[model samples]
Target: MQKRRRFKQTKTLGQRLAEEVTRLRDQARALPPGRSREMLLRKARQDETAIQIESWLRSPGLRAPT
Candidate 1:
Protein backbone atom coordinates (compact mmCIF):
# COMPACT_ATOMS: atom_id res chain seq x y z
CA MET A 1 0.00 0.00 0.00
CA GLN A 2 1.07 3.55 -0.62
CA LYS A 3 2.02 5.46 2.51
CA ARG A 4 -0.40 8.24 3.18
CA ARG A 5 0.96 11.72 3.66
CA ARG A 6 1.09 12.79 7.28
CA PHE A 7 -0.16 16.28 6.47
CA LYS A 8 -1.66 17.92 3.43
CA GLN A 9 -3.30 21.17 2.43
CA THR A 10 -7.02 20.57 2.13
CA LYS A 11 -9.16 22.11 -0.56
CA THR A 12 -12.01 24.54 -0.03
CA LEU A 13 -15.57 23.22 -0.09
CA GLY A 14 -16.33 24.72 -3.48
CA GLN A 15 -13.05 23.46 -4.91
CA ARG A 16 -13.67 19.93 -3.71
CA LEU A 17 -17.19 19.88 -5.08
CA ALA A 18 -16.03 21.18 -8.42
CA GLU A 19 -13.25 18.64 -8.62
CA GLU A 20 -15.66 15.81 -7.91
CA VAL A 21 -18.08 16.96 -10.54
CA THR A 22 -15.29 17.31 -13.07
CA ARG A 23 -14.03 13.80 -12.43
CA LEU A 24 -17.46 12.24 -12.74
CA ARG A 25 -18.10 14.08 -15.97
CA ASP A 26 -14.78 12.93 -17.34
CA GLN A 27 -15.51 9.34 -16.44
CA ALA A 28 -18.92 9.57 -18.01
CA ARG A 29 -17.45 10.93 -21.21
CA ALA A 30 -14.98 8.08 -21.37
CA LEU A 31 -17.76 5.53 -21.58
CA PRO A 32 -20.31 4.63 -24.22
CA PRO A 33 -23.96 5.52 -23.79
CA GLY A 34 -25.23 1.94 -23.83
CA ARG A 35 -22.23 0.15 -22.41
CA SER A 36 -19.79 0.50 -19.52
CA ARG A 37 -16.49 -0.94 -18.45
CA GLU A 38 -16.70 -4.29 -16.68
CA MET A 39 -14.24 -3.04 -14.08
CA LEU A 40 -13.64 0.63 -14.19
CA LEU A 41 -10.25 1.07 -12.58
CA ARG A 42 -9.86 4.38 -14.34
CA LYS A 43 -10.05 7.46 -12.16
CA ALA A 44 -10.91 5.37 -9.15
CA ARG A 45 -9.79 8.07 -6.77
CA GLN A 46 -11.89 10.62 -8.59
CA ASP A 47 -14.92 8.35 -8.51
CA GLU A 48 -14.46 7.81 -4.79
CA THR A 49 -14.03 11.50 -4.16
CA ALA A 50 -17.17 12.26 -6.13
CA ILE A 51 -19.18 9.75 -4.09
CA GLN A 52 -17.82 11.27 -0.89
CA ILE A 53 -18.85 14.70 -2.07
CA GLU A 54 -22.34 13.45 -2.87
CA SER A 55 -22.66 11.93 0.58
CA TRP A 56 -21.41 15.08 2.24
CA LEU A 57 -23.98 17.13 0.39
CA ARG A 58 -26.70 14.86 1.75
CA SER A 59 -25.63 15.27 5.39
CA PRO A 60 -27.32 18.23 7.05
CA GLY A 61 -24.58 18.68 9.67
CA LEU A 62 -21.63 18.20 7.36
CA ARG A 63 -19.06 20.95 7.44
CA ALA A 64 -16.03 21.75 5.33
CA PRO A 65 -12.95 19.83 6.40
CA THR A 66 -10.39 21.82 8.28
Candidate 2:
Protein backbone atom coordinates (compact mmCIF):
# COMPACT_ATOMS: atom_id res chain seq x y z
CA MET A 1 0.00 0.00 0.00
CA GLN A 2 1.21 3.48 -0.81
CA LYS A 3 1.19 6.03 1.97
CA ARG A 4 -0.01 9.52 1.30
CA ARG A 5 2.64 12.23 1.31
CA ARG A 6 2.33 14.59 4.24
CA PHE A 7 3.64 18.11 4.47
CA LYS A 8 3.33 21.05 6.83
CA GLN A 9 2.26 24.51 5.70
CA THR A 10 4.71 27.19 6.84
CA LYS A 11 2.23 30.00 6.30
CA THR A 12 -1.37 30.55 7.36
CA LEU A 13 -4.15 30.42 4.76
CA GLY A 14 -4.61 34.18 4.92
CA GLN A 15 -0.93 34.70 4.31
CA ARG A 16 -0.89 32.31 1.37
CA LEU A 17 -3.99 33.87 -0.15
CA ALA A 18 -2.59 37.35 0.29
CA GLU A 19 0.61 36.32 -1.44
CA GLU A 20 -1.34 34.81 -4.32
CA VAL A 21 -3.38 38.00 -4.71
CA THR A 22 -0.25 40.08 -4.78
CA ARG A 23 1.35 37.83 -7.37
CA LEU A 24 -1.73 37.86 -9.57
CA ARG A 25 -2.06 41.63 -9.42
CA ASP A 26 1.59 42.09 -10.28
CA GLN A 27 1.31 39.75 -13.26
CA ALA A 28 -1.81 41.50 -14.45
CA ARG A 29 -0.15 44.87 -14.18
CA ALA A 30 2.75 43.68 -16.34
CA LEU A 31 0.43 42.49 -19.10
CA PRO A 32 -1.36 44.54 -21.73
CA PRO A 33 -5.07 45.10 -21.01
CA GLY A 34 -6.92 42.09 -22.44
CA ARG A 35 -8.73 38.88 -21.51
CA SER A 36 -5.65 37.38 -19.87
CA ARG A 37 -5.07 40.47 -17.78
CA GLU A 38 -8.74 40.61 -16.88
CA MET A 39 -8.70 36.98 -15.85
CA LEU A 40 -5.70 37.48 -13.61
CA LEU A 41 -7.31 40.52 -12.02
CA ARG A 42 -10.49 38.53 -11.47
CA LYS A 43 -8.52 35.79 -9.72
CA ALA A 44 -6.79 38.38 -7.54
CA ARG A 45 -10.16 39.83 -6.58
CA GLN A 46 -11.40 36.38 -5.63
CA ASP A 47 -8.36 35.80 -3.47
CA GLU A 48 -8.84 39.17 -1.79
CA THR A 49 -12.47 38.28 -1.10
CA ALA A 50 -11.37 34.99 0.40
CA ILE A 51 -8.96 36.82 2.67
CA GLN A 52 -11.71 39.19 3.78
CA ILE A 53 -14.08 36.31 4.52
CA GLU A 54 -11.41 34.47 6.48
CA SER A 55 -10.72 37.55 8.57
CA TRP A 56 -14.43 38.07 9.19
CA LEU A 57 -14.79 34.48 10.29
CA ARG A 58 -11.93 34.84 12.75
CA SER A 59 -13.06 38.23 14.05
CA PRO A 60 -14.25 38.37 17.67
CA GLY A 61 -17.36 40.24 16.54
CA LEU A 62 -18.52 37.25 14.50
CA ARG A 63 -21.74 35.70 15.78
CA ALA A 64 -23.78 32.65 14.89
CA PRO A 65 -26.85 33.37 12.84
CA THR A 66 -29.87 33.70 15.08
Candidate 3:
Protein backbone atom coordinates (compact mmCIF):
# COMPACT_ATOMS: atom_id res chain seq x y z
CA MET A 1 0.00 0.00 0.00
CA GLN A 2 1.23 3.47 -0.89
CA LYS A 3 0.08 6.72 0.61
CA ARG A 4 -0.54 9.69 -1.67
CA ARG A 5 1.34 12.82 -0.80
CA ARG A 6 -0.70 15.97 -0.42
CA PHE A 7 0.84 19.28 -1.27
CA LYS A 8 -0.31 22.51 0.26
CA GLN A 9 -1.91 24.92 -2.16
CA THR A 10 -1.02 28.58 -2.01
CA LYS A 11 -1.52 31.59 -4.25
CA THR A 12 0.72 34.62 -4.46
CA LEU A 13 -0.74 38.11 -4.19
CA GLY A 14 -0.27 38.76 -7.89
CA GLN A 15 -1.90 35.49 -8.81
CA ARG A 16 -4.88 36.15 -6.53
CA LEU A 17 -5.31 39.65 -7.93
CA ALA A 18 -5.13 38.33 -11.48
CA GLU A 19 -7.77 35.73 -10.68
CA GLU A 20 -10.08 38.37 -9.24
CA VAL A 21 -9.67 40.45 -12.37
CA THR A 22 -10.57 37.46 -14.52
CA ARG A 23 -13.61 36.63 -12.42
CA LEU A 24 -14.88 40.21 -12.51
CA ARG A 25 -14.51 40.37 -16.29
CA ASP A 26 -16.30 37.08 -16.74
CA GLN A 27 -19.18 38.19 -14.54
CA ALA A 28 -19.42 41.51 -16.28
CA ARG A 29 -19.58 39.87 -19.69
CA ALA A 30 -22.41 37.60 -18.59
CA LEU A 31 -24.58 40.53 -17.59
CA PRO A 32 -26.63 42.75 -19.90
CA PRO A 33 -25.61 46.37 -20.44
CA GLY A 34 -26.44 48.13 -17.17
CA ARG A 35 -24.93 50.29 -14.45
CA SER A 36 -23.98 47.25 -12.36
CA ARG A 37 -22.21 45.63 -15.27
CA GLU A 38 -20.38 48.88 -15.95
CA MET A 39 -19.25 49.02 -12.37
CA LEU A 40 -17.92 45.46 -12.45
CA LEU A 41 -16.07 46.07 -15.70
CA ARG A 42 -14.52 49.21 -14.29
CA LYS A 43 -13.38 47.35 -11.20
CA ALA A 44 -11.89 44.63 -13.35
CA ARG A 45 -9.93 47.20 -15.36
CA GLN A 46 -8.59 48.72 -12.16
CA ASP A 47 -7.47 45.32 -10.86
CA GLU A 48 -5.77 44.53 -14.15
CA THR A 49 -3.92 47.83 -14.02
CA ALA A 50 -2.79 47.12 -10.48
CA ILE A 51 -1.45 43.73 -11.53
CA GLN A 52 0.49 45.38 -14.35
CA ILE A 53 1.99 47.89 -11.96
CA GLU A 54 2.95 45.15 -9.51
CA SER A 55 4.71 43.22 -12.25
CA TRP A 56 6.53 46.32 -13.38
CA LEU A 57 7.75 47.03 -9.87
CA ARG A 58 9.10 43.51 -9.57
CA SER A 59 10.72 43.46 -13.02
CA PRO A 60 14.44 42.60 -12.94
CA GLY A 61 15.12 45.07 -15.78
CA LEU A 62 14.00 47.98 -13.59
CA ARG A 63 16.86 50.17 -12.34
CA ALA A 64 17.05 52.33 -9.25
CA PRO A 65 17.87 56.04 -9.43
CA THR A 66 21.58 56.86 -9.82
Candidate 4:
Protein backbone atom coordinates (compact mmCIF):
# COMPACT_ATOMS: atom_id res chain seq x y z
CA MET A 1 0.00 0.00 0.00
CA GLN A 2 1.22 3.52 -0.83
CA LYS A 3 0.75 6.44 1.52
CA ARG A 4 -0.99 9.49 0.17
CA ARG A 5 -0.01 13.04 1.03
CA ARG A 6 -2.28 16.05 1.14
CA PHE A 7 -1.18 19.63 0.55
CA LYS A 8 -2.80 22.64 2.16
CA GLN A 9 -3.19 25.90 0.33
CA THR A 10 -3.00 29.29 2.02
CA LYS A 11 -4.86 32.43 1.00
CA THR A 12 -2.95 35.56 0.11
CA LEU A 13 -3.47 38.70 2.19
CA GLY A 14 -5.70 40.25 -0.49
CA GLN A 15 -7.86 37.12 -0.75
CA ARG A 16 -8.30 36.99 3.03
CA LEU A 17 -9.20 40.66 3.21
CA ALA A 18 -11.77 40.27 0.41
CA GLU A 19 -13.42 37.32 2.20
CA GLU A 20 -13.59 39.33 5.42
CA VAL A 21 -15.25 42.20 3.57
CA THR A 22 -17.85 39.85 2.14
CA ARG A 23 -18.62 38.40 5.58
CA LEU A 24 -18.95 41.83 7.17
CA ARG A 25 -21.26 43.05 4.44
CA ASP A 26 -23.48 39.98 4.80
CA GLN A 27 -23.73 40.45 8.55
CA ALA A 28 -24.54 44.11 8.16
CA ARG A 29 -27.33 43.36 5.69
CA ALA A 30 -28.98 40.92 8.11
CA LEU A 31 -29.03 43.43 10.97
CA PRO A 32 -31.45 46.29 11.43
CA PRO A 33 -30.12 49.82 11.03
CA GLY A 34 -28.37 50.72 14.29
CA ARG A 35 -24.97 51.18 15.91
CA SER A 36 -23.89 47.55 15.43
CA ARG A 37 -24.92 47.58 11.79
CA GLU A 38 -23.13 50.86 11.23
CA MET A 39 -19.97 49.47 12.81
CA LEU A 40 -20.00 46.37 10.65
CA LEU A 41 -20.53 48.41 7.47
CA ARG A 42 -17.70 50.71 8.43
CA LYS A 43 -15.38 47.75 8.99
CA ALA A 44 -16.36 46.31 5.63
CA ARG A 45 -15.54 49.57 3.93
CA GLN A 46 -12.17 49.65 5.61
CA ASP A 47 -11.38 46.15 4.48
CA GLU A 48 -12.35 47.06 0.89
CA THR A 49 -10.05 50.04 1.01
CA ALA A 50 -7.26 47.85 2.30
CA ILE A 51 -7.80 45.44 -0.54
CA GLN A 52 -7.59 48.25 -3.08
CA ILE A 53 -4.42 49.55 -1.52
CA GLU A 54 -2.90 46.11 -1.50
CA SER A 55 -3.67 45.72 -5.21
CA TRP A 56 -2.18 49.10 -5.98
CA LEU A 57 0.96 48.32 -4.03
CA ARG A 58 1.37 45.05 -5.91
CA SER A 59 0.90 46.62 -9.35
CA PRO A 60 3.88 46.17 -11.67
CA GLY A 61 4.55 49.86 -12.36
CA LEU A 62 5.06 50.64 -8.69
CA ARG A 63 8.00 48.29 -8.32
CA ALA A 64 11.34 50.00 -7.58
CA PRO A 65 13.30 50.61 -10.78
CA THR A 66 15.95 47.94 -11.19
Q: What is the full ranking by lDDT, best candidate first? A: 2, 4, 3, 1
Could you give candidate 4's per-residue lDDT for residues 1-66 as a string of tens digits?
A: 999998675999899999999999999999999999999999999999899888888898886534
| Cα RMSD for predicted model 3 | 6.7
Predicted structure 2, TM vs. truth: 0.86
Give each model's whole-structure lDDT.
0.64, 0.93, 0.88, 0.91
Please give, for residues 1-66, the per-residue lDDT of candidate 2 as tens digits. Answer: 999999999999999999999999999999998999999999999999899889889989797534
**In candidate 4, what residue range of length 10 has the lowest lDDT sum?**
57-66
**The best candidate in terms of TM-score:** 2
Per TM-score, what order, best first? 2, 4, 3, 1
TM-score of each predicted structure versus truth? 0.38, 0.86, 0.72, 0.77
lDDT of 2 at 13: 95
Better of 1 and 4 by lDDT: 4
User: Of the candidates shown, which would achieve the greatest lDDT relative to the real structure?
Assistant: 2
The reply for model 3, stretches above 4 Å from the true place, is 1-9, 61-66
Estimate, for each residue in 1-66, the C-alpha lDDT of model 3 and write its tens digit: 999999765986689898999999999999999999999999988988888778778989886534
The runs of at least 3 residues in candidate 1 whose Cα sits more than 4 Å from the true structure, single-residue gaps closed, are 1-9, 35-66
